[model samples]
Target: MDDTQTMHAMGIDDAYHVEQVLARGPRGVTELVTIDGVGPFVRKKIPTVLAQRGVWSALGGSTCPRLPRVEATYELPDCVAVVLDYIPGLTLEQAVAERGRLQQNEAVSLAQQICEAVQELHRLGILHRDLTPANIIVADDGAHIIDLGIARPFTNTANRNRDTTALGTYGFASPEQYGFAPTDVRSDIFSLGRILGFMLTGIYPDDASYATLLADDPNITPRLRAVVERASAFEPSARYQSVQQFAQALTAPSDPVDPVVPAPVSMLGASNGGIRTRAIIIAAIAGIVIVALVAAMTLIPRWVANGDAEGTAANGTSQNAGPQPNTSPDDNDDDMVPSPDSSTQDSEDDDATRGDAAYDNPLELVETGWSADESGLVHYAFGLRNTSDSVCIQFPSVEITGRSEDGSVLFSHTQALMVAFPGETTYFGSQAGNSNGTVPATVDFTILEPEDYNYVNSGESASFKVDNLNAAPDGYGGEIFSGDIFVTKDSERVREQSSQLNVSLVLRDDAGAIIYGYTTFVDWPPEGGSRPFSMDVFDPPAYDSFEVYAQPW
Candidate 1:
């Protein structure tokens, strides 16, 4: 296909002056072009049959530094032209071929940058279905991501289907990219792992001459190899759930249980002697909780009947109590309980809240931060890790205060926390409306030992399964979703109340901040079956991703 003829047919010659022909072949025309005032961009004239290049318009003026901003896109009779800001750098493929293999630290550095760029793509609801060394440009700052020719919008579904075309570079592509399953963030992570390996070895993982991990690979670091192995796990669930997580694993310090063994910076550090240590600690915690819970259960009935217990949880108080407030808000946790990973280390791989004021305190504030919506309703979401060996902070309340530059309080309120079991972590979230559309300069958290908030050290059942989730834009431009919920297991409860299901949703923006929160209810399904649920969030804000939580009230 001649580039001049294609431009002439579309009348693009009138608006875009073709300065140079960059490449023209079966892949169609890609050229450097200039406009009346603006100049120098790579315009890709892709045939409609190849891709609906009009989708590139969404990337115009991309805020991500690693992405070549799409300046404009045009739809022609038989082709769509995408004009992107020209990035001046060698593609990683060219660099590797010209200069040989990259250093280990250099490879890790570039991988981190690529990870960040992919994270931005994910935030934009786009998946770079094909992330290869040839598509990444090695610039001064780091790597720049290009060629969204095979990108697709992110759609999370438990019943995911295969990619129709299965398009990707053989060596760098994830198995799912070859139609094994729908590619998501993990697919990009997989390619990243392959790129790291390629950069160090000068050969793809699929190459016939590829080096055996240990035998021929002496240049790769111990911990980095472990990171790559997990990042390139055959199972998507086994890989890092998000790029942020992958980066953490890459940068976190490694410890060897024994000098001869390499430690994996995993969610539970499940490697070498660490897994055994983790398992033993977990077992000890579980056994202690079970014994204490059994004792509490046996005595509760008799105590209630004989009036030997506190009159009501509302009148109870913690020994760490402050001046009791005359009245306290009802425990909002009854509305939504966060069931994060069972591991106390946190699924986010957050451990900063430990080892300082952590072990000494029963309830350690794992992480605290705040975000706001377009309307400026400040929302605070924080994680609380219960370090206690035999206690569950039932309805633990916290005083949240937003402050300004001078430390003047802007808004103050209390939110009840959920049940963080012994050595387990729970989360709390709350929102406050601001009159002037101004967010807080900073947010602070304070534990409140209110007289009324429930504090139970007893055990209860906590089993739930929410899957096959699907989201769609309501014709009116709002977001709606549906999914299935199952009561995988039941817990023993007191005779005073019946178990009820409460479903909570946390819609997050690209930065992983909560933009919206909503709660709903669903009926229990028949024994061994699941119940379907549909929910609509009113005044729903725009979000790229979301997390769901289900629990009993």
Candidate 2:
């Protein structure tokens, strides 16, 4: 194929011609080329040395939207090359270098979108072995997850069980990815979290060791820090179960409060006058409670504005105060957001009045599949019912969080919705318009972190009304749809059971070939309960299909 000057042996079509080299990597070089009628294109040629690496199949099944569109595949005598759509965007590495660290909100948004893209791939049973900033592209409109040459599908084969020669960018690879065991979705989450840490602090945590990063970044909020710390956990199981969970944890709102306790005169070692000490103690306690309440009021507004589910209301407004800051120099402040532990306080209050209420409600949820158009956006819908008459469901909010396979939170948002009456269902979906504001459907969140890729979250959900005419087929050969949902409740009754709902429609042709399909997930009952569930749809081919297979990374 290399010897042919025009239209070579790899079955080179006249439609495309090589232009120039864009970037070179260990596996191959990506080239800028022109398709006869299709404008700019990218052609990636796998080197002879890496020809045996089954990347073609990996790219085919990958759901990463940021990845270059796979136009066609070719098998050359000496090498293999795949043609793809040329994307116009800058590498994330460049964006960070130029802009320094991104603003917290911007970073979170970008990370969340990336996570959703990755989640799409993971849901299809694929994994991107190599994940790094250099492989990610950030466009003016949104970020793109590129470079899947080392990706592989999760099949029940020996290859999926064994470790490979550690293949990926060093700083971005998880410890377990280095031949410790076969890499899983969580492995990607670990790498994604590391990338996020680098994006936020400009320091690679895995390279310097997470402990070092924690010791150095004093400004890092505790909640954010906790996310990094958890993502960087040595053991894969210790990390988040999914990328959505990680994103939710990272984006969950927080408020600052003081930590001080008054000591009685007797406890203070017999002061000169017990009366004076008592007065001082009483004043201190009063001051602390009043100050805490005041801080709670100020912080709650910002927290709610950011769309976090943790904020609560007392009387009529949000009264939940965030965690107290640790004053120690070694404490990483950014990682220090209020823990979910505080949410129990509200539950305790609810438990006290359980018997007096007219009825008790067990949390339940229902969800529908997601749909998407040609532009590759996703949409989802869900139905929720307040089953109990006793518990006056006040401010109940739903949060949808996405995670990478490695359990890093990519994106999360607490959507506001009109309250649902008992036994009533509400419908919602992705925001209106495309990236250019043309299409009426678009995924609600954008993932900025690496872990945001290839993950899902529960609690928040999307609502939808059935459309029999638009329904698609289900299974492996069917088409798919995608979108999001918005859920909300008042702050008073926040802790409730969460639910996961899957929506899928199947289509079949006259020959019984799965023509089109749609599938998505929504977790409602929004808060606590139930283990994570996976969403998958597959159909076997009628005949032995000549499919591409790759060595697992």
Candidate 3:
């Protein structure tokens, strides 16, 4: 591969024969090139800004199954030329024109593939701001996402208030991509929603008849239609938070009660489990009268004491905010984002400690931010580092409060968090698209400590390790670390539940100072077997080295 990487040293015209001119526009010219010894590849000449060079360099090193691999990249004064493996297939746009719109199951299948691809891009910190049928190719291997001409990395700075560039393809770009709000992982999700709708309605989102056509289509399931509606909501926060979530929704069980709810369970996401409303409904109906009386008795005095507590509804911000680390001089200069925690579970006041370490409110807020847009949309995200040496505890949920000028709790929501193992950082909070847009005068985060939990001892310290670890470029000039987790415990001795591991990436500089972090849930290794995993960090402060934190999920 190093020998092939040197191909970029030669000029494009000198290295391969230009077989055909495929596209020409502001994204630059696209041509099919054929090498005598090699095969056909798509070469794109993309005009670059100071900000785009890093993205091009990263793309040159990125690798994903559903995305076309970049063979080489050449940078010029004005544009960067990228050579991508060419796959023969029709674009989804053309596929729809030839065959009629897809059925529910067909669209769902393809949508899942696209979601998987987009989720990977987001994981690499690249947002495919433009997602439409035309950018997807239907090939033998399945759907391949093409065209990163308009792709951009997630902003690595704290000043990312909005997508400064208001350029996105019409009909599919999220409102945030139009500079309404800052574009993040959710922006791509909005576009995928538009693509899903196009698959069923055969009409672009910008079309006047598109909405009615999609809603009135008898073939499209009401359940599927709801997915499209939520995905394309004008508010960025209203959309599925991540593609993994969107994909889960596409294949959700038809029965409302049985649906695998798209809850934000981790950095990458988890698929199983949901709230059983039947029991809740029965309990609610039976206790309404008593509950109302209880509420009246408990609320009146508390409401008086906590002036803005419930009244924060009018002064509150949005519900779910995407992750954007707010770094300050005193904080570690690392670019990170928050990820969701676990699903519903019971909590008890059981003080759990690990191997001589006592829990003393171990959470340290390393990064924080709160912002709102003119559209009344609000977003807030913060990174938390567990300072304890070996203590790992449950932060089942996080309470973020929006306070009034006098520092009174206006309103707050129980935000999710990625399980942060000892000495690692995880993000908390989500974007709320339909927020009141009121920027809180003061924001407070309260980590609700779990009541009871399990604690592992030091004897199992060497329970797992990465094998054949490999590091590659993540396209935005960052690095991707991948390896297989080999469990040291004997397969016969370990229970299946004990193999569920939560892994987090820790990137540090040459001097070993922390820079970036991310946490994800790994698939259970087969009864103490091994499973592969990768960590994508976009534009970390330094890429000198990395560390992986693995513990029971």
Candidate 4:
């Protein structure tokens, strides 16, 4: 309808002038109107029949602070028009696009605010069946929830016999809403968690289906993940018992209760203002307490886990903390216990030429090129040539270690193949049966310092075995192994070529904290005309200093 026609139909005369259309939904349209009687107002147009059912009046008196204030409601010949205060802000969806994934702090803040709004609406016996990114607007001041056209009230008698159409966006709606059952505050909480998940990970959970999101990227804090999983439970009885409980779950830092599945909370006790009012007041206070707890829990974990490097750095207290004992490497060897195999003799023969096939002294070892099949699992080939004919070299079995970028150990395993020979090459790879146990391909091999290696026979070829190979995605975001392979002829020490190679490792546990790092260097035995080569591991936020280490090879 035209601006003049709508204004006249509502009996506002020339005093009300329509400016522009603001938003359009399934049940109604909202317009920005400038009235001479009132400066500016949002005019929402709904069907007269629907307004007569008292849905609009109930929603108009709701305590949801985020919803626009209703100024007036008038009936026209075929439709009903209600005037409301204009809310100015950008939608949450827009903010997400501009700022990739929000930090944990920002996400929790927004979620708590949304929960408070939901709690208020529920206290007033109203349900905002539609709660999605589009319905939530964010301003510099605060966030506002809008669009209550499909909102139903607890006291509506017609709602008892009404076959309301399923309402809500695909990804945001609770399962019960889709089943044509009564929606409660818990349903909104489920949508809130989905929104929080989207804010943390750039991807939305809805695009891939709720089942897929839960399986692949439940991108949230562990505690929050548990709550969201429960909120989105398929059964209604499995959901939060009340809006207060849902709000508590959203605002609570710890574990939360699941919703009811078989049947939602009955509305029998809702008429008594004393009981409902006390419940609402109690919920509000509980919400505040929970918000405080959530904030503390979210922020405290990060602070306590990060050590006191700040003060240490300021005091100039020797940047090198010295090598702390990493039980990780030794622990990884234990994980390499090979399964009983009938081809143990063949495996021994393969290791015979390489070296002594024992699991001791992994430092003296060498490996050839690595390869991976179509399945993306890697295999390393080691060629150990024994220079001494008199001494029978005993090769040690290989072991793989997994660590995060921050030096936190995740997994370690041992390979069964052993080598026993003066000079030979052997092949080793992730165990065939252990394919399903593969970690993310992005881990790193921790290169031992120069002191860690033992030189033999005039340093002809000092062997340095990598006892652990951490897997990684592309070997990025962590340490890459590179070191020198030096040889000496006499005490005069005529330096030969310096060998340097890069080895990539994977990182697991995206949420784990990083602790230590080191790097390797090339261009050994520097001459007057030779260029300098170097590598260093650095701490993040500010990677000013890094530990320098020498390789065994």
Positional deviation of residue 481's Cα in model 1 after best superposition, in angstroms: 38
For all candidates in order, the CA lDDT equals: 0.55, 0.43, 0.55, 0.42
Worst 10 residues of 1 by lDDT: 295-304
Q: What TM-score, computed on C-alpha atoms, does each candidate reach?
A: 0.43, 0.42, 0.45, 0.42
Best by TM-score: 3
The window of 10 residues in a row where model 3 has the poorest summed lDDT is 295-304
Predicted structure 4: lDDT:
0.42
- In angstroms, give how far residue 366 of model 4 lies from its true place: 68
The parts of candidate 3 lying over 4 Å away from their true place are 1-13, 60-62, 254-553
Sort by lDDT, best first: 1, 3, 2, 4
Off by over 4 Å in 1: 1-13, 24-27, 36-38, 49-55, 156-159, 213-218, 255-553
Q: lDDT (0-100) at residue 301 of candidate 1?
A: 12
Model 2, range 96-174, lDDT digits (tens) per residue? 8787766666777878877876777777677776677877888877888877766777756353332433345545666
lDDT of 1 at 14: 59
